[model samples]
Target chain A: MEATDRNNREGLKAWLNPSRYGAERISYWLQRLTGVGLLGYFIGHVYETSSLTQGPDAWAAMLELTQTPMGHMILLLVIGMSTFHSANGIRLIFTEGGKGLGKPGRPDYPYDAVSLNYRQKSGIWIALILAAAAMLFGASVLFGGE
Target chain B: MSETIEKLERLDKKRKEHEKKEIERSSIYLKIFRANRATGEQAHYDTVEVPVQRSTTVLDALLYAKGYKDHSIGIRYSCRMASCGSCGMKINGIPRLACYTKVSELYGDTITCEPLSNFPHIRDLATDFTQFFEHHKDMQPYIQNENADIKDPSKLSEFVQSPEDVDKFLQFSYCIKCGCCYSACPTVAMDTKFPGPQALAQAYRYFADSRDAATEERLELVDDRHGIFRCHFAGSCSTVCPKGVDPALGIQLLKGHMLGYSSNEKKIADLKERLMRK
Candidate 1:
């Protein structure tokens, strides 16, 4: 009974957390957040690539800066979010483009017409796998896991 | 004095003869939903027994109840025909002109009368129209075409329109602004951003007009989330529209135009979706 009570208390705490509403709100915010994340990453990538214009020394300095523990972690986080956002966007593009996410046969129907189905589920699974792989690769280079 | 007495006797005889021939009518209970906004109290219904004859309209019943039974019942009525656009209310869960709805057609002893939906209630069966009419005013619902300066009929000439071109917008042009469709719209109930069915229908009326210079500009107004996309096409607005203007069709047509699809192609897509879902 005590153990059961402890489990119930933890459940209650989880429900009461501020992030409870945050999770539910994510689906609607997913597109906007992903757009912002991708734009930021693209800008940063362009700046880093521009270093090659200066000399090899500038390029090496930028690379070494990204090799630090905190820098490496930030890069991994950005890549992970970008992959998730991109996959979800692809799922939406199919939906908005009238490819069936809900109804299987009628691929050209509007997003609202077909109820969301396994195609979207597949998109989500694929995104998660790609993000995990990126994270693993990112950690390996930084931590000597390679 | 003798002439007045003789006249009174003749009128009495006529009254007696008319009573003998007069058909006995039934009395009905009108259940009206009343809300007091001053107190910030919610709506509640009160049933009033009204004496109604076969020829009596719903407006007649309301007037009878107000004049004889209770004077506090609030109602706005003028030009009792459907032309005036006043006396609009929800009769039996549908927005209808009280002057036009016959009392004999209503089933059950109790007929529910309430204000039009999607507006703030002022009193029993009366709604605040400031918001409803403001939507139309925002659109600048007048012709802004090149021909606005052409006053002379002979100089201007009629805009050459075939029967088909005229028919597309003819149905939408008959809006009385009675707000029957606006009240009955479920989408309007959910979101205020959605420029309700009436406004969208009006927008399309001008957008389809050949002479209207601001078609593209008007389309931009209704192209956003709060504009045409909010309509789920429940078809209730079309059902309740007194003038037979199908705002549902207008909204669907507007949506098709906004989505970059031909009307016929979108219709086929809708049909295909329906079949696939089943």
Candidate 2:
């Protein structure tokens, strides 16, 4: 079927474009993307572990994949993504559940919404800092260790 | 004396040049998005040159284009002030009201004007708001008092509320229905069933209102999986709101009440009607 411009919605483009908005909006889809990525890694890890049923020969072959340089890099990324995903998810539980966000009041001029202010935005910064620290530690363990 | 006069002449020339730069009058091209569904015309941009001052708004430039350049250009506006909530569009990819946003506030030599996303496009820079209004209607924006009947025969009854009580819902009440928040919402872009920010905020406004009854039905209305739950609280809704109506806060607070985290109990303001026996 041919297409039409009738429904010209921004679709997922709107979700991906963080440059258009502020911290909270950017972290929203970043959190979701990392979550999906971690899930994929989790499934791959399970499949890799399933090789244990075939004894040392099969397990050793599967372990070879992780012993590769690419595998180490991916593992390091997973460590960071997982850390961020969990930390931000915990923050969202309180935010989406309607705590920490201040009660609505008169929005005086130069209107600052309590949701977009530093209190909520600071949570996003904390999550990023946690992710970076976790990734640094993972790099040391994966690459710097004997 | 002649050397001093010459120095003053040079300074005056410099002062005049400085004053000219201070006013900052320049011409900017408004690359307006043009669409024609009736003629099945594919969407495109038509660049129009508009002389602008520091005080010129997006609405002013668009009006100039329509007034002199092209009479066929489609644009919607009522009150030139921000109160009408008519002229809203995506100026440089951000959903904002054309009337309220001064051209000086925007950073660009070429301004791009497009119809708001998440709404069905009607024509150039104009989108269909029927569905948006319908979603708003579904929320039952007006007062839904159960005991609205007049119990007495002679005097009038006024639902008197304190300033503290008014503060709860007063912020959300300022929605101009401009749909800037709706356009800014990423969830609204993808999820059609989600009631969007405008409607959900109105729901919280009335639900939080001290005089309003019918809390159970209001809660049930926005309690669907596609309803309040769809809002991930990305907060683009709150950020894009031109009138300071924080729809994101309203939705989250509503979620709080829905999830039993916050108190749903409203004192149901005391009726100040005359109870005098004639």
Best by DockQ: 2
lDDT of each: 0.67, 0.86
What is the lDDT for B208 in model 1? 65
TM-score of 1: 0.55
Give the alpha carbon lDDT tens digit for every residue of B170-231 in model 2. Answer: 99989999989999999888887789999999999999988888788999999898898899
Give lDDT tens digits, candidate 2, residues A19-52: 7878888899889789889999999999999999
DockQ of predictions, in order shown:
0.01, 0.48
TM-score (C-alpha) between model 2 and the true structure = 0.89
**Shift of residue A53 alpha carbon in model 2, Å:** 3.0
lDDT of 1 by residue, B35-76 (tens): 766555577888999988877889999999899988989898
TM-score of each candidate?
A: 0.55, 0.89
